[model samples]
Every structure is written in C-alpha cells, then in structure tokens.
Target chain A: MYLAKIYVTYKPSILDPKGETVKDALHRLDYQAVSDVVMGKYFEIKIANDNESDVRKMVEAFSQQLLINVNMEVFRYELIALSTAV
Target chain B: MYLAKIYVTYKPSILDPKGETVKDALHRLDYQAVSDVVMGKYFEIKIANDNESDVRKMVEAFSQQLLINVNMEVFRYELIALSTAV
Candidate 1:
C-alpha cells in the first residue's frame, strides 16, 4: 500500500476572499502584525499498489481529473509507502 | 516577524467536487489505483512582530474572522519566527 499526499492551492494572482477575510480578522484581533493570510487544501490518499511508476501515473491522472481546477488551482503530490518495514 | 501557516480543509462529510473530478480523471488516465481525491487550501501569513503571545492572539482572531468559514471549512495554524539568527 502507498500513501499519496496532495497539496492544492489557488493561483497566486487570484483573489481569495477567504484569505482576505482571515487577514482582516487577524488585524482586528490585535495581531496587527499579521499582514496576510492565504488558504489552500491538502489531501492524503491511500492506494493499494506496489509499482512506483504506476502510482505516479495514477497521481498524474488524478491531478488532471478531479484533484484540481486547472483554471483556478494547482496541485502537487508525494507518494510514500505505508509499510516502512524496510 | 513570524510566519503563520494555516491549513484549510473541507469537512469529511462535505462533498468536494474538485476532488471527485480529480479521481475520475485519474481513473481515465489509467491510474485506476487511485480511488479518491479531496482538495483544500493552505495559507501562509507573514507577520511583522516578535511577541509570541500577541501573534497567537492575532492568529486566533484571524481564524475566527476571515481564515475559516466556521461553517463549511476548518483551519489550524502555527507561528514560526523569520529570524532564527539566535
């Protein structure tokens, strides 16, 4: 089995209202030291496969499919073995 | 200055269409090993302060305000110093 960790994020240039709101809140919360806040998503997926090449193919396909919005978001991932018994 | 890293994620019960789409894409891409994909957001905030207590207060307020939906999303954060010259 393998573990795939994916990090999803909004394009830097895009305006993230969620992030803006958090930054504003920080400022008001007396943390005027905080100037910015941006938010993104992270996912950890488990797969039952042993082939590294196959897993990469899987993650690449996953990214292209449902994992990301090419228009607004970008994604990156890392795959690790579940059994570090080695 | 400090760095606030906020990780935002969709509640498990919530349906992430983006994640679904990525999963579907992975299947079609011949990575059938991939069964699911869930996406979320990550925000990194840079604060201009050295007071740890003040920074925590700021992040807590930010999370309550614009950092998290409190309804649809959840967030967690950590603060690290920018200058480790010590």
Candidate 2:
C-alpha cells in the first residue's frame, strides 16, 4: 500500500475571502504582525496499490480531476510506501 | 518576517464526508485502488514579525483559536523566516 499526502492551494493571483476574513479576525485580536493569509485544501490518501509509479499516476489524476479545481488551484503530493505484515 | 504553512485535518476517528464523497467518485471513475481518503485544510500565513519565537507563539495562537476547530480538527505548522533587505 502507499499513502499520498497532498497539499492544494489557490494560485497567488486569486482572491481568498476565507483567508482575508481570518486575517481581519487576527488583526481584531491584536495579531497585527500577521498578513498575507492564503487558505487551501489538504488530503491524506491510502492506496491499495504498491507500485510507486502507479500510485503517483492515480493520485495525480485524483488531484486534477476531483480533488482540486485546476482553474484556480494547484496541488502537490508526496507518496510514502506503507509497511505490510507478512 | 515569517511565513507559516499550516495544515489542519480531522482526527482519524472523525468522519469525513467530503473525503468519503471523493472516494465514492473515484471508485465510480474506476480508481478502486484508492481508499481511506481524508480531506483537510491548508493555510499560508505571512507574518511581519521578525522574532521567531513571537511568530511561533502567534501562529500557534491563531491555529488554536481561529484556524482549526478544536472539537474535531488538529493543526500543525512550519515557520520560515524571510530574507530581509540589507
């Protein structure tokens, strides 16, 4: 089995209202030092396949097709092989 | 300045409907090799503070109070210091 840890975030040019709201809240709470807040999505996926290449392809497809909106977001992933008991 | 990259995810025991829906969609698309899909949040925060310790404290406080729902989600962050113009 393989595990893919995926991180997805908005492109720099996009406006993130959620992040802005959080930033305003932080300022309201007196965290004046905070700024430029951008928010996105994360995913942890367990794959039944053992082949690294195959897992990568599957994860990439998932990210592009279902997990992220490619119109405004970008994604990156790291794959880890899982230990199996004999 | 400091940049904090934060990841927030549901506890393993928590039910993730979003992940489940994605999984179902993947299965429908014939990616049966995929399973255990968990979805979460990612944030990129730029802080004006130069002090590493102060930035860490502020990010931690933000994570606890604003970034994550303590009842179900847990957060982790990495802080990076920005280069200052001499």
Candidate 3:
C-alpha cells in the first residue's frame, strides 16, 4: 500500500486575497508579527496499489486533472510506502 | 523571518463527505487503486518575528481561536527560520 500527501496552492503570480484577509485578521488578533499568509489545500490519500511508478502516475494525473486549476494553481505530492502484515 | 506551515483537518470521528465524494469521483475516473481520501487546509505563513517561542505561541493562539473549529478540526504547525540578507 501507499500513502499520498498532496498539497495544492496558488501559482506565484496569483493574488491570494483570502490569504491577505487572513493576514489582516491575524494582525487584528494581535499577531502583528505575521507578515504574509498563503492558503492552500492538503489531501491525504491511501491507495491499495503497491506499484510505486503507477502510484506516482495516478496521483500526478489526479492532481493535475482534478485538484488544481492549471492556470492559477499548482500541486505537488509525496508517495510513501506502507508495510502491512498479511 | 520565519515560515509557519500549518495544516488543519477534520477529527477522525468526523464524517468527511467531501473527501468521500472525491474518492468516489476518482473511482469513476478509473483510479480504482485509491482506497481513501481525506482533505484539509494548508497555510504558509511568513512571520517577521524572530523569537521562536513567541512565534509558536502566536501560532498556537491563532490556530486554536481562529483557524480550527474546536470540536471538529485539529491543527498542527511547523515553524522554520529563514535567513535574510541585510
């Protein structure tokens, strides 16, 4: 089995107003030291498949095709192997 | 400067319908290897403060009071120092 951790975030050029608002909110909450905030999405997935190369391909396809907006967002993922006793 | 990477996710007992829906969608897309999916939020924050303890405290407060729903979600963070060229 494999576990995939995926993170999807805005492209560098994209303006993250939600993040900006959160930064402002933090400042109001007395966290004045906070300078910037970028918000993103995280996904934890468990795949029953064991083929490393196939797992990578599947995650890559899912992130690119479904999880992110190709023009404004980008995604990255890490696949880790899990040991299971039969 | 410091970078705080925060992740917030639903408590294990909570029902994550969104994640379930995504998993079902993936299966429809022929990603039959996928067994489970959990989705959460990620925040990349930049803090101007240099004091590690102070930063940690601030993040702890912000996460508890604002970022997470005390009953349904839990959060974790990693603080990293960044070198600045003056």
Candidate 4:
C-alpha cells in the first residue's frame, strides 16, 4: 500500500477567521511571538496499490479534482510507502 | 510583506486517532467517499519585510525550530507576495 498526505489552505488574499482566533489565543497565552495564523485541512489517502508512481498519480488527480478549491485555496501532497517491515 | 503557508502532518507509521474519528464522522454524515482524515496544524507567518529570499529563510528556520516535529511529522511551505496593487 501507499500513503498519501494532503494539505489544503486558503489563498493569501483571503482572510482566515479560524487562524485569527488561534492567533489571539496564543497571544493571550503569552506566545506573543506569533504574529498570524491560517488554518487548513489535512487528509491521508491510503492507496491499496503499492506502486509509488501509481500512488503519486492518484494523489495528484485527487487533489486536483476534490481535495482543493483552486478559487480559494491550494494543495500539495506527498507519497510514502506503507510499510518497511519483513 | 511575505505570506508563508505552512502545513504539518503526522508520519504515516504513526496511528492517527484524530483521522479515524473524522473518518467515522464523515461516514456518519453519509460522505462515504472519504476514507480517512488526518489532522494537522496550518500557519501563515507574515513577515514585515518583503524580501522574498529573507522571508523564505525565516520560514525555513521557523519550521525547523518550532513549527514541526521531525520525529512525528513533516511540513512544507510556500511563499506568496502580500500585495500587488499599485
């Protein structure tokens, strides 16, 4: 099997309310060094097939088709082997 | 200013309870297409300085030092210009 890690986030031009809330909380907690925060979604897609190339293709297609909203966000992903055990 | 979008996710070998919970939620919500959901932290670090190279360096350093745990997670980022209006 192959493991696909995907990340999706809002475009720079849009305001992120959730991130702002977290930023405020962090500041309140004395983490003043943090200036801003933007929140995003993460997903792991497990492909039953073990071929790295095939997994990459599937993840690329999935991200482009369903994982991200290009009008508001961008996404990227990585593929890794599911197991290295004997 | 520069916009730094960072994404962090758990390593594949690690068991992700959060992801499983989300998967269950989706299933309950009738979104059967979703097989899994892995949660992660996302941040947008705004740099006061607009130098792209400097911002990239700062983000890289920040991610390595405070943003992600190399043992349990991986992260990646992208840089975008904050403004283009004249």
Best by DockQ: 3
Candidate 1 - chain A - TM: 0.86
How much is B34 displaced in model 4, in angstroms?
1.6
TM-score of chain B of each: 0.83, 0.93, 0.95, 0.85
Judged by TM-score, which candidate is best? 3
Encode model 2's per-residue lDDT on A1-86: one tens digit a residue.
99999998888888888889888998998898886888888888999988999888889987899888899988999999998767
* lDDT value, candidate 2, whole model: 0.89
For model 1, what is the C-alpha lDDT against the true structure? 0.74
TM-score of each: 0.67, 0.93, 0.96, 0.54
lDDT of 3 by residue, A5-86 (tens): 9999999999998898888888889888888899999999999988899899889998888888999999988888998656
The candidate, 3 or 4, that scores higher on TM-score is: 3
Candidate ranking (lDDT, best to worst)? 3, 2, 1, 4
Q: After superposition, how far is residue A53 of candidate 3 from its true place, in Å?
A: 1.2
Model 1 residue A32 lDDT score? 70
Candidates' DockQ values?
A: 0.53, 0.89, 0.92, 0.26
Model 1 interface Cα RMSD in Å: 2.6
**Backbone clashes in each candidate structure, one number apiece?**
16, 0, 0, 0
Residues A1-86 of candidate 4 have per-residue lDDT tens digits of 77777778888898778878766765665545456777888777665666678667666765676556878888878777777457
**TM-score winner between candidates 1 and 4:** 1
Task: Give me the displacement of residue A25 in model 2, in angstroms.
Answer: 1.2
